[model samples]
Every structure is written in structure tokens, then in C-alpha cells.
Target: PPRFTAQNHGNLKNEEEKEEEEDRRDILAHRGSLTVRRWYPVGTVLAGLYSVPPLNEVVAPPPGMATRLCFSVEYRHSCEQLMVSLLRLGNLPPRFHGNIMLVELRLLPDDRRPRQAKARRTGPDPEFCDCFVFQVSGVCVPQSTLSVCVLSVEQDGKRHAVGRVLFPLEGELGQAGRVLWRDLETEDDTQVPCSELGDVQISLMYSPCLQRLSVVVLRARGLQLLTDAGVCVQVSLRIHTQVVKIKRSFVAKCENDPYFDHRMTFKLHSQHLDEACLRFELQQPNNVHSGERPPALLGVLVLGPFMYARGPQLQHWMDMVNTPQEPVELWHGLGRAT
Candidate 1:
């Protein structure tokens, strides 16, 4: 069932307001000047059995100073599906005085049969076949600490707990917090291979009061896949805000190979944004289009930008291409210039 809440809606509004202010500043600073460049890498793997670290980390803001956090995740593997949830916990200094601001969940590969394992072979049915990558971005709230948790679940209802790194308001640079993988539990009766699942989980904790940020990466392995079968990858993003109370979600899917069909979806909270404009393109080797024809274009529906306080506002953009109607040619720009 789809999860929706009032608190989530409020957060979305706060983020929208913050984003609008930033956009206004940018536009005023560079009037009549719009620089649209490809910031995310192409041919990026979105789904895989392995785990990759977030693109960047947040720095601790000075005590009482507001800060922003930014990160991303990529997956490149032939797994049945992938699900990611981002959680934010607040108030852990002396007394738990803060609120749980955000809980975002992303469901990737909108269409696909529930994955089922094939009959086991002889010794050790190859383990660790699902791979994925993720990136997270957000701003630090004043007078609050941030904690992030990434959980990866596989087919057959097997749940694997990655790692949980903590960011404290006051702590040594390297002594923030560590995730104890050995302490995590697995649902399958079979003993989970420690090496494969060791570093699959990644977490980032930040404290505005102390102005400190800590990042940790966890990995794990299970359910090997035959290389002969081509792989499909999916990616999704969910945003949750407390100030304005909004929950926004974006989903995309694509095949690892360029010759297959892929689909993408964008979902947003209704009360947050006015409208979302999305441009899709295909970049080929030697600056060519994917096929003989032009690429298709689409737009995302957003209620408008939600308002927020001092920190950076949350804005939505499609950094990656989940599916292309035709093979993308080597050229980058918004929707084929009409």
C-alpha cells in the first residue's frame, strides 16, 4: 500500500519554499542566462547487487548554523527489483527533543514479476547477484541532528540489514559512529555470507549544532545471477519534509543493455509544487542521436515549490535517463528544441 501522511506534506511545502528562493536568486544573478549542462554521468548503472557510496557528503554546520546535505545512489546489475527507503531522525542530545522529519521510500521497476530463485545446484548456490547504487542530498536543519539508513531487500522475502552510521552533534572527526554488520539479522534460514553483505549499507549522519558530518558504507552479498542473462536496472527518489508537510516521489526504470525497452515515472505531492518541466535526451558516442529519429520528451507534474526556512530548499530534477524511446545520440539538451 502507498504510504501518505500529513507531516510528510508539511515538509514538502517547506522544501518547495526553500527551492523557490534559491531559483529566484539564481535567475536574478544570471538574468536571461540559463546554463543547462549534464551534471550526472551517462550510461550510469542504477541497479546492481553491489553497493556504492553516495556521490558526496555533508559538512557539519557551525553550532546553530543551518546546513545542506547532498548525495546520490547508482545501481548496475540484473536484479529482479530494488527498493530504497530514506529515514531522518532528530533530537538526540541530552534529551530527545527533535522530531522525525522525513521517511521516504522509492519503489523501482514499476513493472516486473516478483523474482523467484531457480532450483539450487551443487556446492554453494552462487551468492551476491543483486547490485545497486544510491545518492542522497538534503540541507541540515537548525538545532537538529540527522541520521540516514539504507535498507536492501531481495526476492523470496529475504531482508538484509546493511549498516547504520551515526553523525553526532559533538564528536571527533573519525569517531562519529560505525555500523556493526555482524549485529544485523537476516530473514533466510541459511547463514548470510558476511563477506558478500559486509559493506552493502551506507549511512550519513549530520549535526547542525556541532557542524559535523559523518559517512559510512556497508556491503553484503546474496542470490547470484547468471551473467548470460542480460540485466535490467531501475532507479527511484523520494523526498519528505516536515516544515510544510509533504511527501514527493520519483521513479525510473531501464534495461542495462541499450537494445531493450525501459520505462520511467515521476510522482510528486499535490500541495507542494505548481508544475514540473522535465526534458529527456539521448547522447550517443561521437555526438549522435540514439536512432534515426528525434528522442521523445516528457514533463513531471509538481504542485509547485514548497516553502522552507533558512536551509537550502529541495528542488526536483531528472539527473538520469531511465528509458529512451530510441538509442540516444551523442548530443545533450532539453527536449529536441521543439
Candidate 2:
């Protein structure tokens, strides 16, 4: 061992830090599937937070309120874009002070379940930085882009579009330690076309006489090629905390715009119709052994008591409501899950 002054001790510490960082990088060399890669932070977040109600005032939350949110993304592997992620949002708004926000991270082009961080703030902006520090094991490649979305969580637990940010990895990191900040933009700032994610079509008919709700999956469009080409469906019914799930067969890999000859029917009781819900999910099943890879979510439709009164769900709801005598067909744009 060589002895030295205070400068040598400082140099030793820096060398240790560098060695640790190299160890972490070696561990992260393989990611998409293996669970061996541990979760770690990217760095400090540089973000600009906002609110439509003018966040400078004091606001208190009402009693007995809770937030329910799911940030969903129908995964897409390629489109001449990047694949990256921000640090995990610790929680929605991190603290409650009458602030409303929804935090969502979209990375898996193959997962049906949306990953999210949801919470409510009861006052003005926090006394410190309200940064959403996201983390991931594998997505730090060149030209890869990560999306950070902030939506509004309503009292009824539905998420509405609010604002979003895109982090482009290339040329973003000038030095190894410097983090940057940017502004978040809402739909009002710019209109984003829905056709980017593509669409799915279905037909529905409810027969009071037969006491059944019938659904026919027509087709899906604009899905990522080859990898996510083969798809399947899952239909579910929930009544009084009890759930019934049915998994359908997968379409052929050759069918990009898949059409199913499949028709799903559910028995409905008049008394439960007021409180029942029907859910149809488009999923890309895992091809290898179970747990070898996570499945991606293509799209999903939830039909509930008040669903038809809403936008896309309503488009089909009213069509059948007007002509209960026949089945109604409609196409809907696929949206991000969260």
C-alpha cells in the first residue's frame, strides 16, 4: 500500500465511485426479459409543473376522497422512434394539497397492465422540487425516447388527458452528471392526432329477451408489425366484487389487421345490469415459456352502467340504445391505458 495526504484519500473515493458505476453498467448489459437486472434511478429530474386552476392559491381537499389511476400504453416496438424511460414517479403529486395529477410511464410495448404513480395534493405546489424521478434497467440506447404523461384524475376515478413530455436521449446528456429540465404540454397546447396508435372495431347487441350481452370483435389496425402481429382477446365481467374472465384464442401471425370470427356472449340479469361492467381487452400473449417475457397490451374497452354516456364508449352505447332491435357496429381509436 502507498501512503499519501488528504488528496490521495479523495482520489481513492472517486476511484471507488467509478468502479461501482462500472459494476452497475455491467449488470445492466442484459434487460428486456431477465429479472436479474435491479431497478435503479436514471438521475435527478428537470421538469416544469403546472395546473389549470392557477396553483398559487391555497386549496384543501374534500373528505372521504380517494384516487384511482392506471397509466396504460398499448405497446409499440418500432416506428422510427426511440425507446427510453424517465425515473419512476414516486407518487402522484407526491403530496396532497388540492393538486390533481396523473403520472404514467410507457415502456413495455408488450404489457397489458399499465404502470403508474397516483396521489392527490391538498395545497399549492410543494415547498421543494416536485420531480418525478423515473427508473429503468435497459432503455438507455441512442435515439431512444421516453414519454412522461401527466393527466387529471377526476373524482369518479377516470383519467383525462392533461400534459406530457418527451425525453430524447441523443444529445441530451452533454456531461455524465448534468440533468436538464423542460416544460410539460397539455392537449390544449397542441392537438395530437389519435390515428397514431391506430384503431379497433367491434359490434355489440344487448337482448333483453335473451337476457344476454353479445359482442363481436371485428378488427384492429395500425399495430406494430411482425412482433405484435399475433393477438388474442380477453373478456371479463365484474359484479359485486366478483370477476369472471375468459381468454380467447390468438389470431394468426400473418394477420396484421386481424378479423375474428369469434363472438362472445355474456348472460345478464336485469337486476345486476345497473351495477355490472363488461371489459374487453386486446392482449399480445407471451410466445415463450411463462415468465420468459411479459405480454403487451394492444387495447381495451370497458362497458359499464354510465359508459355509453361518455365519449367513445357512448358512440357505440347510443347506437345500440337507439336500435335495441339490432346489433350496432363502430370503430374506436385506441388510447394509452393510464
Candidate 3:
């Protein structure tokens, strides 16, 4: 029995419409003039398709910073000091078992002395809820950083570093009160040269008026291999065969998270913009270059325009183009040199 009701007629109509749309698309494809319809802008559509993070969103648990530490920082105006509260730690390694874990807090560069929390029984997860105060009476707190280190003490009273994280005093945490979770880098993460390349945080800005590009290398983790070595980030600008400029960050050694906080600028003309590309190489001492081979690079990252870059790299570059003169910060995972 053939039923011709309103619902049946509507279903048939939808099928016919879909078939017509497909036929139209096929015809357009054959003509090489196909343009897919989208509700959002091209950049938005591509970002969604690639699962890339929005430009404003902060990436959590950075590529190499697997271990995380939770804590809060507050500045006391009256006391003229900073108070750091130790909250809790997540993802404590299995090696911490049967040992006592402790959290240490201190200001970096100027203050080498560390204020440590009371050691607690080792467990998968532990909470300290401890408080430590650092007197910044005459010191410029804005220029300093708060370094957090998690250590495990053996029965023999030998202490070993479990993980470490560096929290800058400036930025969002500079205010009176703020709580944040930061990645704690471990030795094992960067000990061996494996498939997992480390991660680097950088900010890029391009000014059309000045015809210049600025790159700021903020911090990096999980770059060490074999042992703790002095690592410096080398930034180079190249357009095909011609090299525009080369710069390097000051070497940071023997730390979980090395903070470079260096900015390099290059004069980029409008005509060569499309072919220009920036290359980042994490270079280590001794392994600078193995004879005729290239530098023993810990990791490498590339950023360029649309034709040369893809995924998040391309998006980062496009964002700079779309909003000139504004800095765009992103966390890029380093990949082994091919």
C-alpha cells in the first residue's frame, strides 16, 4: 500500500533536495569552481576542523610538563611581602613511594634561598595546605619569579628532585590574589631522546607599518637529553636560500623550566612575506654540530604563512596577519629534526 501523507511527502521532498544539492556539487567540482558553504569564517571553520585551540585560550599541562602543581600567590601590601600557599600536587610519580615529599618555594635570580614545607608521607596524591612568606620589602617583586620544587627524601635523608615548576611574579598572578595550576617538569620527561619532543612557549607579533616581525621566546621544558645541559634557543629567519637574520636566547641550564623571556625582531618586507619562515632550534652544548651533520637539535619548530605552514602553525601566523601589531602567544610542541 502506497501512503501519500504530509509527513511522507516532506521526507520525499528532503531526499529530493539532498540529491539535487549533491548533483549541483558534483557539477561544480567537474567545472573546478566548487566552493563549500560554511556558516563561519574560513579561519574559524579550519580551526574547528583541525581541533586547534582558540588564540585566547591557555593550553593546560603543556606537552612536556606532564606533572602539575596547584598553588596560590598573594601579595600583602601592608607587610610588604608575598605569601605563597601550597595547595596540592597531582600526578606524583610512583618513585615517590616509601619516601617523604616536600614542596619548596622561593624567589628566583635574586633569592637563591628556598622556603620549604613540612615533609609528608609519600602517596599518589598529597595535600600540604601550607603557607610560606617571602619578605620583598626593598626588592622589586615584578622583576622576580617564584620557583616551586617538589622533592622526595629517602630514609637515608638523601633528597632527590621529583619535579619543578617556575611561576613568574608578573602577569595575571601579580595581583593581590590568584590561584593557578602550573606544569611541573620532571627529569625523566627529558632524560631520553624519544618521539615526544618537548614544548616551548612563544609570542609572535608583526607590524605592517614598521615592516618588522617580533618573536618572544617565553619558556621551554622537556628539552634535556642524557643529563642536564646548557640549552639555548636559536631563532632564524629565512626566505628560500637567503637568510635574513639569526638570534639566540641566553643559555639556561640545570632547571626544569628554562625561562628565556627574550625578544628578537627582524625586518620583513611586504613582497617577501609569503616566502619568509621562522625556524626555532633548541641547541645543546657539545652536541652543537656532529661533524658534517646538522646541529644536535633537541627539538625544532617552524612557523610560516599559509602556503608553507598548516594546522596551528598556520593559524598562529594568520592571526598575526589578521591583527597586526598585537602579540599572539602560543605553546608549540617541539618535534625531532627530520
Candidate 4:
């Protein structure tokens, strides 16, 4: 053995300290750090936190409240505009605290401007012949949805959602000069429904040769943010009860409608494809007070195979798998993560 020197002893001590630090980091990483990637067994994916109910069922309104809304939607293809006219409301519920009611017209997937009719005191029925014009140039009206919400103003100057009608703009509904009456659906009075959280457009592609899956976040609309802080999109790839990968898009200014245009790719073996799932979350970082807490999850959209996904989510996944390397894109309504 060589003679021991002070420098040699110091080097050995530093090496030991480095090893200890790395060991500590590894231990902490297993505590659900988003930046770290790990693998889990296949069984975890089968019975995991990602298991959620299919979003195909319509929510029935509460009994004794058969509110209905009459509106006409006209799509001016030549002018690339959509004209919405609020004709009247019938079977309205009784108001509380001497509040008045109003109607809000919103065009989905694009255009965040909501036109509100003047609030007025009415009996069981009210009429508002208000017409609002929205430019729908970039939006695909046939694939979009229109939200007609009836609201009531409280004495405290707060507005509450009385009932809402989500009308799909497709087929005859998408044609110009079409008028219809639809029943308004109501959710729990205590909280806002997940359908009001917003909507997101996602694009997915998988390549078997390389065993890679790519996901792109195109845009989101009608998002309700708590603050003015910017928001980022977080994509989590969870398999076997473990989040294997987490990626985020660049922070963009908070807006009712924001465009992410971010793409994240993951390398996945075809054997485990059936067990893999993707989670899209809108994270609103608290920029004002850094280190105060982690980013808040505004809304979430989870997509997987038929085992957990259904409706449009299942169809989108099948389209991508059937046509490998070809991209499949679709719009999904965001819901509060269960």
C-alpha cells in the first residue's frame, strides 16, 4: 500500500460523501417526483388510481326543475360568423333573495367572449330577444359545441349557474338558420360541474417500428382559472401504478382560451401498450409566491385503452393504434380528476 497523505484522505472522504448524497436523492426520488422516471409491474395498471368511470352518460337534471331554453344558431359560412339569438326561457325555477336571471351564450373550442343578456325580473317564463355575433373563422363549427347557460344573480353580487344547455353543433344543428329548444341540465347546487372546467384538443400517434408514442396538446378553450398567473400543461405517462414519465409545456399567459402546441414522446414496448395510460393536467403555477407550494391542477383529461377509456377517448386511441404512424386528433371535455 502507498503512504497515506492529507490530500488522499480528503479525496476518500469526499467520495464517501458524494455516494451518501446520491443515495439520499434516490430515496427521495421514489416519493413521487415528477422529474424522475420509474417502472412498475403490469398488475398495478389493472387496478390503479387511474381507473375512472366512462364519460358517456348524460346527467339528468334534478326533479321538479324542468327549465327549458329557446335559442337559434345560424352559421354564416360566407362571413365565417355564427349568430346566436336567445329567444326565451320557460319553466324557470323560483329565485332566491330577489335575484334576477340572465342568459349567456358561449361558442366552444374557440372564442371565449361570452355574451350576456340583460338581467330582468320575470315570472316562470322570460323572453330575451338578444342576438350576438361571433366570428368563428378558425373553429370547426361542425365538431364544436355551444354552451347556453342560464344564470341568476345573488344579493351579494355573485352570479350562479342556474342551468346550462350543451348543444352539439353538427349535422342539421350546424347548418345555417336552425332554431331549437333544449332542456337545461342542472348539477349539484354546491359545486360547478366538470363540464364547465373546459375542453382540450389532443393529437396522438404511435409507431410500432420504434415503439414510441407521441402526444400533442394543441389548445384548450373555456378554461376557468382561479388566478391571473400563467398555466402549463403536464402530461403524465403512468403504467403499473407508477408514473413513468412527466413532461410539461412552456408556461403561457393565463387566458380563458390558451394554445399549448406542445408535444411529448415516450418510448413504450408494444407488449405493455395495453397497460399504459396518459394523463393531461392543466397546472397553474403560483408565480407570485415561489416555493409556497406546488402548481395547482386546474383540470385533468385521462386517456387509455378500452380498459379505462370510453366514448370519444376510446375511439381516438383505437384510431391511432389501427393506423400506426398516422396522427389522430380529437377534442375532449376536461373534468375534475377523481
* Total clashing pairs for each candidate: 78, 28, 0, 0
By lDDT, the candidates rank as: 4, 3, 2, 1
- lDDT comparing candidate 1 with the true structure: 0.25
> Which pairs clash (backbone N, Cα, C closer than 3 Å) in model 4?
none
lDDT of 2 by residue, 124-171 (tens): 332222333224323443334445555555666544444455555445
Q: What does candidate 1's lDDT look like per residue over 158-182, in tens digits?
A: 3322222222222221221221111
lDDT of each: 0.25, 0.51, 0.71, 0.73
- By lDDT, the better pick of 2 and 3 is 3
Worst 10 residues of 2 by lDDT: 67-76
Off-target runs (Cα >4 Å) in candidate 2 are 1-195, 225-229, 291-294, 307-309
- Model 4 C-alpha lDDT per residue in residues 273-292, reported as the tens digit of each score: 77888999998998667686
Q: In model 3, which range of ten residues has the least summed lDDT?
A: 54-63
Candidate 3, position 96, lDDT: 80
- Model 3 ranges with Cα > 4 A deviation: 1-195, 287-295
Query: In model 4, which range of ten residues has the least summed lDDT?
Result: 54-63
lDDT of 4 at 325: 79
Clash pairs detected, candidate 3: none
Q: Can you write out model 3's per-residue Cα lDDT over 1-338, one digit (the tens) per residue?
A: 99865567788999988987887666555554445442222222456567855322432223342567877788777887788878777666677867888876657544535577854445755667788888885347776677786777788876666767767777644455555778776645544433366788778889998999999999887665544667788999999757788998888774656888999999998777778989899876564455664444788898887555654465456546645777877677787676
Worst 10 residues of 1 by lDDT: 311-320
Query: What's the TM-score of each model vs. the native?
Result: 0.15, 0.39, 0.41, 0.43
